[model samples]
Every structure is written in C-alpha cells, then in structure tokens.
Target: MMSDCGLDYIELLQQEVDRTSAKLLYLRNEEEPEEAPPPRHTPHTCSAPRRLAISPGLGGKPLTPPFTENLRRLLFGRTVRVFNFDWRKSFFHFREPNSELSYALQVDQGGARAVQMVIQARIIKHLLFSQQGGSEGRSLLSLTELGPPEQQGALAAALSDSLWLAGQEESATVTMVTEDDSPKPPSEYRLDLLTEKMHTFVFNRKEELSSFLLDHIHCFQEEGGHGVVLFLYSLVCSRTIDRIREDLDSSTAHLLQRRLGNFVCSQALLNLLLTGRATPHVCNGTQAPGGGAAPLDPPLQGVLSRGDIGYLHWSREQMDRDRLLQVGSMLKTPRFPVWLCCINSTYSVLFSLTRSLLSDWRTEHQFQLFYYNGQNSQNSTARLTIDTHSHHWEAPSVDPGVDLEKRFPSLEMTIRTKWEGASINWGGIPPFY
Candidate 1:
C-alpha cells in the first residue's frame, strides 16, 4: 500500500536532517565558542549587513544566521518553510534597545511556539530596555561564565525581575520538560518531544529562583535544550498556572495545538504574548458571543491591557466570508508604534522609529514604515511610505455594487486599523501582501 514517492520523500527528508545534524555537530566541536561578545554593542549601522536576530546559544555567543538556519533546517527540514523572522533565526541580547538585529528576533510563524517566542521577545525587551539600570549585555554575553556563582546569581535575579513584569503584576508559571543527559535535543530533532518528563516550577520569591535557573541554564541554552521553549515556560510560571488557565476559555484548553505534524499558537496564546492576559479575541475587552443568547461560561477574553508591542490581524479567508473580527482600539492603538501584523495568518512586523507615530496625528500625513516578511530572500529592510489624506480611499474606481472589503489589499486594511480612513501608497514598491 505504501507508495514509492512517499517513501522517497521521507528518506530524502531524513537524509537532510542527518546531514545537517552532522554538520552542526562538527561545527560545535571544532569551533571554539566565539570570544565572549563585546559587553556593549553599537546599534546596527546601515553600513554592515545585519544578521538575523537570534538568541545566544549554550556557548553564550549570539547565534549567527548560518547556525540558526542550520537549526531550522535540521529541526523542521523541508517540512516547514524557514523564515528569517522565525525564532530559530534570531538571537537574544541581555540589553540592547538600539540594536537593529534585535528587530528580527520576534516570531512571525503560526504555532504556539511562535506565540511563546513573541512573548519571550517582549519579556527580554522589557528586561533589557524597560529597566534603566538592569543587567547589561555583558552579563548575558558569555553564558559560559554562568558557572561562576556570582554570575549565576546575577543572571537569575535579572530573569526573575523580567518574568515578574511579564506576568503583568500577577504571578507567573514556568513549565518545562526535564532531560536527564546528552546535549542533543530529543527524538525527531526536538520536534517530537511529546514523551519528555514535564515539570512546573514556582519561585516563592524572585530571588529564590536565581540558583535553579543559573545552574541549569545549559538545559535551557544548550544545542538541544529547547532553550526558547524553556524560556517561555519560565515566563509562564512567573505568571502562574492558574492565570494561564483563566486566560483560556472553554474552547482553547492549551497554548499550542498540533497540526500537520507541527504546532501552532492559538489566539489566546498570542493575546498573552501581546498583553499578558491571554485573552483569546482581538477586541478591546471581554465580550459575550453574538446572538445575545445567554453568555457562555468563562466569557471570551480580549486584550485587557496593552503590551509593549501591538498586534494587527487581517484574514482574507475571514473577510471574504464577512467573518472578520473588528480588532478593538486597544490593540489598534498600542502604547508603542510597533505592530506585529498577522496578514492572512502569516506574521510580519511593521514599525516606525517615531514614538509619536500613534499618538500624534500631525505626523501621519506622510511617513515611512518599515516591513520585514522574515523570508530568506529579503536582504535589506523593506521601507514603505504611508500617505494619509492623499488619495481618496473613500471613493473606489471599481463598481459601487462590488464588495469593497474584498477589493483592497489586506495591508491597507491593517494599516487603516490605526489611521481609520487613510490611503496607502506603496511608493513604487509593489505591495506583496
């Protein structure tokens, strides 16, 4: 009953995994972890090519693109298309707000892991930039030094504080799988970690958590440690399990749902990543389902508080059927100008350097907004000009009888979330979305 083509595909995929894995193993052994990175890094200058933003590895070196590319190629192989914006391609710095490489570190993919990675990026940003005199990049630059008791304590305290804030004032919960030995990740190259022993941890106080994490930092950062996932678990723990449960409604029982042999994030998980409340919907606040029937148990949760970054969602599938959820103002109007946009279920980031881009209406007439699709093809940042009050978006050239919502490019609709009735001029750069 088995077809030869299917068998060939499996065999080829397995060979790729093995080849990539071997290549990485060789690199890890032969290559001494790069010198402890400079404690302080200058902001990405337009002069140098910006590497994909990936977190440091077990070796304490900021992961480079080739290495992360190999990671995704090894783990997902050809099964899933790899993107530069995927968590695997980025690195984490202890504190570097003025860094360009940091921009690509967020997850632009579809799974629960993607959501957690996004939340993890926010947590790291809060730790590094939010606090004025917190741990410097030097503190995290060389994880090899975590063995030292002093450094271990310092790292722990810093992580604890960040996670505390990540909880949004509520306690957090950290859930992780326990591994006994070996540096390599589990079967299926860390993709099939279903049977690993899982553990949930709570630190009575933030300081008390310093030792365990410092001692086991390798378990989180090592080549096979599932470092990102471990980091997410720690953040969740700081928020506590109870809150995570409350963040979900009857429909979504967990943060991730498996599909097509891979895992993807739920809206609740994404809301948690954005606002920390894990509200499932995109609306401003909790709302009962339509039809005015008796409200369902555990009323639908929307974003309660705005997070550091905002989210914009536009689904053509949902819009075509007139099922688009009107994302509320709270999400549309965030505390910051950066937004993680979900266009047709794929994630992309749109941001402006001007902090007042959202609050100040005067600056909206003509401005530059940068976009990154996370695809490997992109070598430089794509810049787009948004011209509001320029063209008459109100009057379309198309027949009045046609459905307008389905006519416009999805990106225009997403941007309109903030500008209301602005026209988008691609500035001669063909709009991809």
Candidate 2:
C-alpha cells in the first residue's frame, strides 16, 4: 500500500509540472506570431482574436484610450463575485454589485477560452449599459443618439457582436467556409444596419415590420443571426415595437420563436440580470447524423413554474390570436407572479418573479395594457395577476420593498404612467371589487 501511494504521488507531481510548463509555454507563445492561421472549423479560437480587433466606438472608430479605461473602472469599480449554479457543469458568473447586473458565461471545456468569453461579455455589458448612466437611464436610444452618427453605428455593432458572444454560438466575426458553402464576408451581416432597419420597421410602420419580419424569419434561424434575433426579441419585450395587432399573421413569428427557444436558453442571461445569478441552460452538443448541426439542450425543459424576465413585447392582438406567445396563458403558472414590463424597444430591463405584487381578484384573472407616444418613445409594464386594485398608475411611485425606481428612475416612470386608470378585471366584477 505504501509503495502504491508513493507511485500515485509521483504521478500527481509530474502532472503538475506538465501543467505549469504548458502555461509558461503558452505565455511565451503569445509574444510570437503563428506561422499559419488555424484551419477552418476551429470553434472558440477564431472569435476571440477577431473580436479584439473590433473598435470600441461607432462606425468602426476606436474610442479614446481613456474611454475603455473609464468603462473598466465603472464596471469593476465595486464588489464583484462569481459562483457556480450547477455543480456538474462549467458555467461561471461575472457580477458587479455597483452595476446590479450578472452575466452567464458557459464553458463546456476546461481552458482559458471560457475565461476569455466571460471577459468579453463583461466588456460588452459595460459598453451597453454602463455607458448610458447605468441601468436606470439605460436606453438604446441613448446609445444610438448620444454620439455622432458614425459612433451610433459602431455602438450598435458592438451590441450585436456582444449578444452573439454571450449566446456562445459560433463566431460570426470569424468566417470559415467549407466546400459545401461559399464564404459570407462578415460585412454582409452588419448589425448596425440591421439594428437601424429594425428600428425603422418596428417603430415607423408596425404592419410592414411584421410582414418584413415574417419574410426574413428564416435568416434568424441561421447560426450567425441567432444572436441578432435574440437581441431583437429582447428589444421587442422592451415594448419598443408599437401597435402590435392581432389581425397580423404571425405563424412565421411563432415558428421562429419556437426554433429560437429550442435552439438557445436565454433564461440564464435573464436570471443573471434579475437575480444576479450566472446560471444559463446548457447541454452537451450532439452532432446530428450526416454531419448536420448539433442542438443545445433546452435549458427550460425540466424546470417548472414558467417565467421569462427580460424585455417582452406582449401585444394584445398577437396574444389573442396565439396563446403560445402569451405569458399568462402558459400551461403551468410559475410559483411566483410573473413581473413583465416593456421598456421600449431600444433597450431591455431585467425582472424577477415576485408574488408580493399580486393582489386577490378571482381564481384566474389576467389582463394586459399598451402605451406608445405615437412613436417609439415610451415604456410600459405588463402586470400578470388578476388584482382589481383601483390604484391609479403614476410616475415616481416606487415598487413597495424594492428600489427599482431608484435604480432606473426614467424606466419606472415610463412603465408606471402607461397603466394609469386602465385597470381591467376578468371576474366580471366592477373596478371596486
């Protein structure tokens, strides 16, 4: 037994030496250029170096050196923590209390790549949220309008790229073509242009946007655009898309959503923002037969009590036609009342499941409301309970026991005023019930 133990200890020591040697060699390698680029189909390696090449300003202009330094200082200035949600997996949490935001970065393999992805995500969040007076006054409108037109485009592109990174999908920035397909230059899918079009479509002509979305829904399912689609979904939830009507045909919309829901689990991201947990749904990728694409394990499949806590655009007409898109009509009611609100289409806000907001009305009661300033300049909240409280909606009202108003004053007012005096109860009772 002693001899066996001795042999095991020696083996362990040798392994440690090997690990240290490999790390030192890696550090040395960074100083040298590779003689040849990696072959196509190499996954995480391609995006990292390419993404670093991105300019921090709009329209490919690099920000001043101090700009990034300021962002880093703002993002990581206060306390930060990281923890594992699931023991068996390699997901990590990147959080800062000062920002009140958490990000989920998934790692399927043990290496430096996972850490790189997390750091990438951190920079993206800083660029998106912290740049615009933190989460309270956070607005894509600000991102778009705060700087020069050129800078706006750059900022939008950064957001698009950041969302792609967080999704952990293949790198769109680094293109590698196989014989089966032709190369798609990264310029083809300019997120800044796409974002501009989305804004024009959703905010200008609502009907045209829906039709346009239906026609182009297939693009979202493709690997590279999935992140963009997710970004749009969150944008819509922000209530940026106005005049969502039921007469509009959304079969294509439903199909696209189903595919996206199955393809990626966004709850991990939603949770990180709402509750500061970095737990996202992940599954081992299993390549399909005949070398087809592999699918991500549906993260929300096993969990009960359904709630989505991101920006949601709950169109009454759309929901009336198709209940599948409706949160309240889901087959299973979450243990806590769902807190959903639209924060305009320009940005997204995080929500948590809380029952304290629910009030007694009937066994089952639900209603929704919408608000827009005839343009895209409005935010609204969707209460998912049957409470018939005759409370008038007003701005500057704080959520009881919550400092949401303080965190995001502009957002609170935007949502609060939209629901003013428009209470609807389903119990056939009067407003005074």
Candidate 3:
C-alpha cells in the first residue's frame, strides 16, 4: 500500500508539471503579433489573424483594464472578492475536457453574463468560420467537435477580438469612470460622459482602444477581468451617450436594467455587443414612417447591416399577452447560421452546419439544427430535425382548441422565425424549454 501511494503521488506530480509547462509555452507562442497577416488554418493552432490580432511586447508593459472598486460597484453591482478571480473556484473559469463542450454561463447574475454570452458568440464564430473546405467552410461544429485547449484558445481570441471591435466603434474618446467628488450609492451610479467629474481616455480618430485590448487579452480571459464591462466602457466612450441616444431615439434603448438586486443587459445593449450600434429593434436598417402626414414618433434604429453573428428573441409571456413583436429577416437570416437566442427570457444558442439553410430554401427540407443552452445540466446538444416541407400543422383547420401558440415549442417558434412553416422534431427526446 505504501509503494502504491508513492507511485500515485509521483504520477500526479508529473501531470502537474506537464500542465504547467504546456500552459507557459502556449502563452508565449500566442502573444498577439503586429499587423498579423491572415492566419494559416492549422486546426492545431488558435492564433489571432490580422483583424483579430492585438500586438504585444512593443508597449513598455502589459496593460490591465483599469477597473477600480468604486467603478465595479457602479457597473457590475459588486466587486469580486479577490483583486483577480481564482479560476479554480469559479464557474466562469474554463478547464480541460469540459471547455470543449457547450459550457454554461451563470446568466442569472450580475452584468457578468455579458462575458459568458460574448465568449459563446466568439466560440460560435471560431467553429463556424474555421471549417476547412470551400464547400465545407460553410459548416458549423457541434459541442464536442473541437479539442479542449483549442476551444479555450479560441475563447481567448474571441474575447480579445470583441474588446478590440468595441474599441474600434466610432466614439470621440474611451470613457473611464472614477468616483465623483460627491459620493453616491452604487445603485445610483451611472455612466455619463458629459458630466464634469468624469475621466476620459482620449483615443482620437484612427487610434483604437483595442491597442490596449490586444495586449491584455488574458486580463479578460483568465483573470476574471470583467471584460464585457470594460469593453462596454470602451464602446460607450467611443460612441458617447449622445450618439447612442440618437441611434434609438432619446426615449428607448436603455442599456442596462435592474433585476433581482443586480442589473442585466437590455435588448439594445445585447444588440450593441453583437453589432457596434445599440439599436433597440431587431430589423434591417433604420425603419422610418411611410411618406404620409403621420406623427413623428422617431425612426426605429436596428441592425444597419448584416453582422458576423446574429440575434433572436421570443417569449411565451410576451407572445401570449403583450404586443406581438415579430423578428425581422435581418436577424432571422444572418450572413452565418448561428444566433444568440432569448427564449422565454432565458438565453440559449441555436446553430446549423449548413450555411444555405436560409438563402436557399431547398436546403431547409430536412437539415439538422443543434441547440446549446450554456447549462451543464443539458445531457446532449439538442439535435433538432426540422422538416419544413413535411409539417402538416400550418393550416388553420387543424384545431382551434389546440392553442396553436402553446402547441409549438419556443425553440420551434424561434426556428420558424427564420423558416416560416417548418415543423420541428425533437428526435424522440422529450422537448424542453
């Protein structure tokens, strides 16, 4: 027994050494390169390309996003107990084997959900865009497809890329917040760039905040750096509140709202993360009133153009009681076959391997769709078989007592937003919300 215990201890020590060595090497090799040329597709590597690169080493020292206690209270509702988050203890931390799967983000928390949501978005981008062939590149990967470390690296790349993009948004200066002369409660604190006491980091035209972001990818990725909050600050600083207000009129588009002692992102805020603009509605371009003597209720701001990622929203409660707002084609059919979904007010993701699932109707007949809810509770990626042509329930004569709206699952409703009359099959697995 003593000899066996000794052997096990030695093996464990060796494993630890190997893991540490591998991590150190990965960190050094993946440092962001300057004006990186388009990366060569190596399924083995996760290097950032030119658009995604954040050049390091040129700057005097590594930059961490200057988040302070007061600022954390103001934005995130509370500060993390540690100055830097411990990856081992938190659900937010990415680990081996589990990292490659559809990892869950503790969404019902403070603004931190933004980090998880954005990470998921980036992973989706990496998986969809990273496929090999001309025809095959249009495909998407399932939860278990990529290796653990590669997916983790992809998360690093994606988080950095999002921060860089947020910085690149057209704003006059990058806004940084500090305590005002007259202190206020955390609940009352807000981001107001025009206020006299605010501190602004001036990154004038052409120069972007991403220059700082590229170097500090780990700050957001590994250290629990409140990346999404930091990027939100960068974006708001760039666009300014005045411009954001105009994007959705002065009245609507509230970026954050109070929820269960913490705050969560509003629709406009979610759109801003997905796209650069904080338009409230999910439609194509700005929808204005028809040329008639109608009251000027302000034009609706929406997705100005197609983005690399897309969005979808549906609520059983919203559909049953409130005004039924339909999702437009712009978000319903994106340039890619992936979407960040809000179903019954909970966030989940739905994607397809086939790119032509939208543009060409013929491809929709019987294609597979996979769903990821970011919960460890999910037994498997919900593989849904959509039969657009074979669905017989489209006719009104089917049954009035069936409560048509409740009869269809929310996921099916979400898919029907893109594929209008399609029927969904859960493949013998009982349908879940």
Which predicted model would earn the best lDDT?
3
Q: Which stretches of candidate 3 lie over 4 Å from their true place?
A: 1-92, 95-111, 131-148, 167-215, 237-242, 288-294, 393-400
Q: Which candidate, 1 or 2, would have the higher lDDT against the true structure?
A: 1
Per-residue lDDT of model 3, residues 100-180, tens digit only: 453333332334555466567656666566434523445333445555455555654554444445545433333322223
**Best to worst by TM-score, what's the order?**
3, 1, 2
Candidate 1 local Cα displacement, residue 140, angstroms: 25
Identify the leading candidate in terms of TM-score.
Answer: 3
Displacement of the residue 80 alpha carbon in candidate 1, Å: 23
lDDT of 1 by residue, 1-433 (tens): 8798998787556545644543453334223322422122122111101111122222222222333334334222321222211232222222222333333333334453354345333443443334455332322222222223333343444455446665665444444443221132322222222112234555555444555566664444333334455565456555555666667677676665445434566677677666766667887778776665465555667777666677888888898777776888788777756677888877766766555777778888887776666554454456677788776777865688876556678888888767767777777777775
TM-score of each: 0.60, 0.24, 0.65
RMSD per candidate (Å) reads 14.9, 23.4, 13.2
lDDT of 1 at 302: 79
lDDT of 1 at 326: 81
The superposed Cα distance between candidate 1 and the true structure at residue 102, in angstroms, equals: 6.8
lDDT string for model 2 (5-49, tens) is: 898787556545534443443344333333433222211111111
**Residue 284, candidate 2: C-alpha displacement in angstroms:** 20
